[model samples]
Target: MLSMKVLFAHLGREHLGVEYLSAALKRQGHETALALDPGLFGINDNVFHNARLERRFDQTRRVLRALEEQRPDLAAFTVYTSTFPWALRMAREFKRRSPRTPIVFGGLHPTFEPERTLRCRDADFIIRGEGEGALCDLAHALEHGTDPREIPNLGFRADDDSPALNPLRPLIGNLDDLPFPDKGLFERDINFRDDYIVLCSRGCPHRCSYCCENALHRLHGPGWYRRRSAESVLLELEEMKARYRFREVMFNDPILLTHRGWLEELLEGYRRRIRVPFRCFGQPALMTDAMALLLKHSGCQCVEFGMQTVNEDLKRETLGRPETNEQALNAFRICDRHGLPFDIDHMFGLPGECAADHARALDFYKPLRRLNRIKTHQLVYFPGTAITAEAAE
Candidate 1:
């Protein structure tokens, strides 16, 4: 097989995943480079809270120029829902400069809406779901004149009248097989002091109406919520700690403490071995005072609970979260007692949520505010989410 030069563009968080994939490709005897968009750096909560868009077109252009100079055979990009438009524009620009370079799109947006993404002239291919294996396959295919159609989980347009989607591949159950994301790719560009993120697992089991994870589950099958073993996760963490030396780590899993047994094992392992302060997302119902205390002892400095709203009727009937205000408040109190900083996640503009409901959420958050940080955000109606479908109807 011919060696290929590959460039991966990550427009969001510069974490282990991007680095891991790049390293894996390199290990396969391919040259790899990474371009991380500025937005992925930790958001300025102040500016973000104010809903300000700080567009650094010049910086992006400079990065694009550098990538163009590399003249990679293939350019792959991972785009989030909010950053899709900008990512599309960047892909277009990349294609304009290196028209021969195959530009492929992936991530949550492409996984769910491949047809829509294929419509963009710049994006020659879209890979859905877990991309480590698929990306390597795509790179090799392009380098050796292999057929793109045979690549699993890919979407492209055919000469016929319609877009073609390869058969969806099964989710990677043995996460241990995938190599840890390569941090060396961003060692010079990213500073863990300001930004740090990781993902121990993918997909969420909960079917919250407003959540997009459920949609991701439906995209493939019910078994989308897969995770790496505790040993596997710790290995990655050990490598990250030894290399990057991050003071803090943020697990971006929708719900890090989802599986009680797995979470306990993970926490215990971290406590015994690597004990860097960390934070993660959680649900109130799943978190007991004992678990919260264990997490704190295991170096968990913070936890962000998805309180969503306090309107009981709307919480249950509208968003399908079914979390009681008292339950959430207790969780916050537990975190406080354990001296773990916590953030209450609230969403605005839900279906049937009104000014009164917003007021109710504020009232509910009042008591918890003293215990922890409270955050409120406008509901982003993403494509393929239940709330989005409900809103359309």
Candidate 2:
């Protein structure tokens, strides 16, 4: 098939999803470009803004200007719930400007709410889970003037203009088969210059109630967890080191220490091949003293644990987390003993939380030597999660 350009529009932060999709498209002999909005109102995904103040610094026209310049055959968006409104507005504007070119929406929002997302006339198609193969198929079908209605993991308008969705395909069994994410798309965007980001794995092992991972697990059925081999990851980092000259590596995995054997191999290879300081997420149950020591020896800068609430009862009953409060505290102690700087994720506004719970949390964290941060997040009920259904009742 002849080459066709696919343009991805994203806002608020550097989208790793976009980079991966670009790599997939480019691998298939298709062209790709990015129309990025700096998200000036809120820097680095900390989205906070006043409507009046935000109006003065709207970057829509600038983004649209880039879209017009690129003039891509297909325009795509990687939508999150937080960015859905902005993406919709952008899509509508693009439709007004160029009605013939089709627009496809993919990512978290559209994956869960495909029918609702298709209600918007501008979004011609939506891809549910693991979009690489599905999107490539869609592009090829569109380019070759074939039927895309039968493609797996695709949602689109039917003959009668009602929303139609296809069945999901199996998860990508081997992550190493795909090329490293095409970070070149963000070459002009300055937000993610210092840190080289990578995801060694996809899907979390635990089914936390509030997290979207559970929703994803339901969508893909079984065998959702997948990780790249240590060699595959290190090779990518070596390429990145030569290209970007980054200062630090950020492993953006939900739990990097899930598989001890895989992690040990990766850490050992990382220390030998790439000695850069890196940050990653850990689980309270998994953050043992031995693991902490291994991380410290391998140039780990900071490890973050999701200690959402200190109340073990609330954690087990409400959040579906298996780790106990004692385990969480022990994880902290182990990190402190090993001189490993760590961060704890704390959540407020849990179902049964009161002021006393906050006081208890403070007491729990009163004495810690190597505590790097206590990141706080308010409870949000994402669509189709176990927590969201429970909250509605």
Candidate number achieving the greatest lDDT relative to the actual structure: 2
| Model 2 agreement with the true structure over 180-295: per-residue lDDT tens digits | 99999987885344898999988888899999999898778768888899999999999988888888999999999888899999999999988889999999889887899999
Candidate 2: where is the Cα deviation over 4 Å?
47-53, 191-193
Stretches off by above 4 angstroms in model 1 are: 15-17, 40-46, 49-57, 193-195
Whole-model alpha-carbon lDDT for candidate 1: 0.78
Cα TM-score of candidate 1 = 0.91
Worst window of 10 by summed lDDT in candidate 1: 42-51
lDDT of 1 by residue, 372-393 (tens): 6767777777878787788889
Per-prediction TM-score:
0.91, 0.97
Whole-model Cα lDDT per candidate? 0.78, 0.89
Local lDDT at 366 for model 1: 69
Listed per model in order, the count of residue pairs whose N, CA or C atoms clash below 3 Å is: 5, 0
Model 1 Cα displacement at 381 (Å)? 1.4
